[model samples]
Target: MFLGVDVGTGGTRAILVDRDGRVVVSEACEHQPIHSAEIGWAEQDPDDWWHAAKTAIGGVMRWARENGKAVESVGLTGQMHGCVMLDADGKVLRPALIWCDQRTQPQCDWLNETIGYERMIELTCNPALPNFTLTKLLWVREHQPEIFAKIAHVLCPKDYVRYKLTGEYAIDMQEASGTLLLDVTYRRWSTEVAAAAGIPMSWLPSLFEGPEVCGRILPEASSVTGLAAGTPVVAGAGDQGAGAVGMGILEPGSVSATIGTSGVVFAATAAPTKDAHGRLHTFCHAAPGIWHVMGVTNGAGLSFRYFRDTFTPQLGYDDLTALAAKVPAGSDGMLWVPYLFGERTPHLDPDARAAFIGVTASHTLGHFVRAVLEGVAFSLKDTFTLFEELAIPVEKIRLGGGGARGPLWRQIQADVYNHSVELLEAEEGGAFGAALLAGTGVNAWPSVQAACAATIRAAAVIPPTSAAAMQAAYPRYRRIYPALKGVFQA
Candidate 1:
């Protein structure tokens, strides 16, 4: 059996699976999110992610050992675009500049305008955004120049974990693509991007394919994680790349939809494609030569978290979703713009705040609940529409993430997106995707397509039912941002 370790911002999880992607055992360790109180900034200790990863992997390995399963390779997937700085001894300099940090907006705006937005996007297949690593580095250089000057190697959350295990300093193509320094067209770092961003090319780690066997666990790592010393560590991709593998979306016209801490609508393509408006991002595929265009919503599973904390403090998510079902579609003309933490795709507005639009005296908690749900799905549809514009066909979407745990929300996703939403029998989306790549890298599977065919599970599919209403409602949904766009900048 192979192992897949997923290190996310909130938690780390490890799963033991057979060649067919049937999980035999799995375990997770979740931690509290660390936040900076200076407003609109979030961070996590790299040590915390490592500890949780070890705990999860150790627990799963113990279970696998008890069950008499032999380990082969291990692959990792993680939250993307985080910036982790390592000192001379490979120790973390500070809390990671996490994917959600918004302090780099000014830097992003300056780079986007100064670097010639069209040329950058044409070369990189992505535009400057505050959440990406380049902007984070610029922010650090401007605000904490002293600390920025003393960096040894820069890494993402997954790459840092990989370094701890393998004693190798490297990142994979898929994750590196999020750094905004890599050449999306050439599949290497661009000298022009590095120079323009005022970053030295040497700060970047060596890049590899997601499935490349970078190294094995060192003795110390093995002792902590209970894996064999020579266990192969594959260069796994970012969450979206891995999730696409797990969802069988590596094929053209295939799509993956994840609504977890955030939502994403991603379509894999044989070639890199970008929206003219930069409403979507294109990244290197875990499938190597391929690329994936993605539209990200800043809030996805988070909106449900907000509602849970706001209304049903004592109720389970299932029960709360049941209450949401009591309300009809469209929430009786009520709309919600879930930009609680600003937005990514469609609107790069960092100052954008959230609101429940069109509230009236007749509205109840149920209405509010459902509107929040539909708002997220509709915003996700916004990404889907952009995918349509780019001509990256999305025939169906494989749904994953914590939000997929709720059946009602799953059904709502089906209705609002007006497409069939499918789920995997195995729960670990990103980790499982990583494992598929590992299997391919090791020649356990002839190709990614074959590995996916062996691993991806089609447990159920939710097809659209109320497409007519959603079609009528979508036009109104499209207008919410334009109306609010000016308000955010002011």
Candidate 2:
């Protein structure tokens, strides 16, 4: 059995998979809710994550023991771009500035000015964003110089948990790519960027490719987590990288459109593909010798969730989606801009806001729901537009997360993107992908690609039906953001 552990923003999850890649046991323990003392500042305790991981791992290990399954190897994954700093003794210096924290625009601007935006993109394959690890560190250096001075090591949220499991300070290349300190094209720490930012090279952890064994379970960690000591742990990926692996999106022409709290469109590439305008993110893929280009929508599923919670708390998601199904393709010309948390892909504006345009008394609640569904898909379609500009072929698009579970949303995505979308047999997400990496690390599969080929299978495909309507409505939807940009700022 291979074990995969995901230390997520809200919780820690442990999943055990058999040799054939079927999940044998799974357990999760939720962490304390993120502390947002101020708007745009999100934080979580590293100790809380370690505690949740222990509980979750212990539960899964107990189940495995009862089932007589001997865990062969382990893999780790979690949220990307979080900054977790540690002191010389490996003690947490402060609560981690999490991925959603947007308190670093000043720092982002400084970095962009210092490093040169175009040159920064050439170095890291991404623009300086507040959500990235290096920006968070800069925020700390500016505001809490004392803590910054004492920092001896830095890790992402998942890699911090990896340190608790194993006494090694290491990170996978896929996760390292998000730190803004990595020379993404070379898959190493960017000394120039670090030096310019006044960050020490020693603070960064050693980098490893996904599926490479990086450390072993420590005796102390084994006691708490119930895993045998010395068990090999592979350097897994960040959530997006692992999720893409789980979906079998390892080839150039394959793409994935996933809608969770946010939405992302990811495409694997043979080489790092940069967007000159710094609109899309280019990062290392979990699969070796490959890179990926990604675009993000800050509010995708969140739009629907916010609506249900604010207006119709009584209606479950299924009920709301069912109501949306009754409405026509374009919601009678009403469009939604899903920028509730600001735009990321095409517009990197933190001040961007959400709105429902062309609304009238003629619009019903069902129309609103359908409009929200279509709008989120339209927001994701922005990435496809960029992909086309970059000439990235999209031969297949797989659906994952909340969007893939609903028939209405599935059809809506197919129509909005004007392309066929596929569904996996079991979308176990990052944990399952981490397990595959673990198996690959132990020679259960010769390579990550072969492991995915053996395990990942597409369940069904949804073809575009109302493409003409969505295509006509999309141009109008595009106009809404530009027209309302000044309004949102005011």
Candidate 3:
């Protein structure tokens, strides 16, 4: 058996997968509410993640033991771009500034100014964004100098938990790419970029390729988590990287459109494909010897979540999706801009806001729900446009996350992109991907690609519907951001 652990935003999950990649049991423990003392700022305690991981792992191990299975290897994956600083003794200095935190815009600006924007992109294959780990470090340095002075190491969210388990300072190449400090072309830390950002090179963790065994569980962690001592732990990718692996997007031309709180259009590439304009991100793939280009929509599923919390607290997601199915293709010409947490791809504007344009008294709650659903699909389609521009092949599109669970959203995605969308038979997302990595780590399979091919199979495919109407409305959806860009600033 293989164990896959994902320290997610809302919870920590542990899955036990058999040799054939069948999931035997899975368990999760929810996290406490994220601390948002100020708008555009988000934080979570590293200790909370550790606690949840322990609980989830122990629960999964108990189930595995009952089934007379022993987990031979473990793989880790989690939220990317979080900044977790530790003191000399490895104690967390403060609450981790998580991925959605937008408090580091000034720091982002400073990094670009200091490093030269083009030069920065040349080194990292990405322009510094507020969500990158380096910008969060700069925010701490500027706002809380005393705390910054005590920093001995800087690790991402999952790596911090890995530290607790193995007492090691290591991170995977895919996770390192999001720090805005790696020489992405070489798959190592960039000393030049680190110096330019005013970060000490010693503070960064050692890098490993995903599926490489980076450490072993210590006796202490083994006692708490109920795993055997000295169990090997693999260096897993960040959530996106692992998720793509789980979806079998291992080779070039294969792509995935995943919608969690955020939406990502990830395409595997033979080489690092740079968008000189810095609109799309090029990062190391979890699969060794490869890279990926991705475009993120900061508020995808988030739009629906916001609507549910604000207007339909009494209803569930299935109910909302069913309601949305009643509405037509374009919601009677009403469009929604799902930029509630600002935009990421294309515009790269942090101050952008969400809006429902062309609303009328004739429209009902169902129209609004459908509009939001279509709007998220439209946002993802923008990435496809960029992919076409970059000449990155998109021969296949696999759907994952909440968007894959509903037929309405699946059809909306297919129609909006005007392409066939596939769903996996074992659609476990990141946790399953992590398990595949674990399988590779123990040589249960020769390579990540071989493991994925042996285990993953597509369950269904949805083709485009009302393609002409979708194609027509997409141009209008593209116009919304430009139309409202000035108003958002005002």
Number of clashing pairs per prediction, in order = 1, 0, 0
The C-alpha lDDT values of all candidates are: 0.84, 0.92, 0.93
On TM-score, who's better, 1 or 3?
3
Per-residue lDDT tens digits of candidate 1, residues 161-205?
888888988888999999989898779998998998788777888
**Which residue pairs in candidate 3 collide?**
none
Models 1 onward score TM values of: 0.97, 0.97, 0.99
Could you give the candidate ranking by lDDT, starting with the highest? 3, 2, 1
Residue 459, model 3: lDDT of 91
Give the top-scoring candidate (TM-score). Answer: 3
Tens digit per residue, CA lDDT, model 2, 1-490? 9999988776889999887778888999999987989866789999999999999999999998888888899999998889999999999999999877878989999998999999999999999988899999999999999999999999998999899989899999999999999998999899999999999999999999999999999999999988999999999999889989989999999999999777889999999999999999999999899999999987888799889989999999998887888888999988899988777889987777899999998889999999999999999999999999999999999998889999999999999999999999888888999999999999999999999999988889899999999999999999987887778443
Each prediction's RMSD to truth: 1.5, 1.4, 0.9
**What lDDT does model 3 reach?**
0.93
| TM-score of decoy 3 | 0.99
Q: Report the lDDT tens digits of candidate 3 across residue range 204-287.
A: 998999999999999999999999999999999999999999999978889999998899999999999999988999999999
Q: Lowest summed-lDDT stretch of 10 residues in model 3?
A: 481-490
